[model samples]
Target: YNVTHVPYNGLAPALTGIRDGSVQACMLPYTALVKNLNGKDLRVLAVQSKARLPWLPDVPTTGQQGYPEMDGNDSFVNIAAPKGTPEAVIAKLEGALQKTMQDAGVRKKLEELEVQTMFMGSRETQKWLEDDVRKFSTIIRDAGLSTK
Candidate 1:
């Protein structure tokens, strides 16, 4: 499949372009599209995630359209400190994160994206990242792919 990639400076411009019909189409994370979706001026052709998003139950996933292996469901925002940051600093950051996640508004917005705000401490986050690296590494090797 061939596609054209249009790079926008930020979400505002990209969204404006979509709203004004400057671009024929664009793809973005579903959560990013949620607040504006109900307006009806824009339409969601397909979701990139494996399952249909709760906020957009009517839309089909890319996998459902035919590519069953296409499963890019989730996005994450992580907080990381410098390599030698002290434990107290990490604890403070984690505490703040936990508090933010507890907010009803934030939690509602996150659920719309189908994102579960994970407040894994640095250690657990590191372990998860490491495991992901190994898992993707194996997949890339099997597919004969490389960043290079």
Candidate 2:
């Protein structure tokens, strides 16, 4: 199928376009669509994950919907510091972030917002970041997209 891609500056405007009927559909993080889902303004066709999201249990995963290739595109939220930041400082921040993610209040708020929290140590996060870069770069190259 030939798909025409219309670029939006950000998720907010893209979602607004969908709400106003200017855009027919969009692919966005579940957290960004939580309010619209609660308000019944949008319907989630499928999630691009191997398994269904805990918060949106009723929504089927892309794999479950017969699109296995769409899976493994999970969006993640990460906190980063400068490239030359000290290892000790990075470890301290990672520890604090892990603690925050484990906190009842923080967990509850994230759950309410439909954000899946995956707290990883600095080493794991660095590896994941490298893997994501390589994966996305390959995807872009395969699709003939220009980084410029």
What are the candidates' C-alpha RMSDs? 4.6, 2.0
Per-prediction backbone clash count: 0, 0
Tell me the whole-model lDDT of each prediction, alpha carbons only.
0.75, 0.83
lDDT of 2 by residue, 20-127 (tens): 998788899877887788449999888888789887788899899886766878888878899999999998998888888999999898877778777888788789
Best by TM-score: 2
For residue 139, what is the lDDT in candidate 2?
A: 77
TM-score for each of the candidates: 0.62, 0.86
Give the worst 10-residue stretch by lDDT in candidate 1.
67-76
Backbone clash tally (model 2):
0
Ten-residue region with minimum lDDT total, candidate 2: 1-10
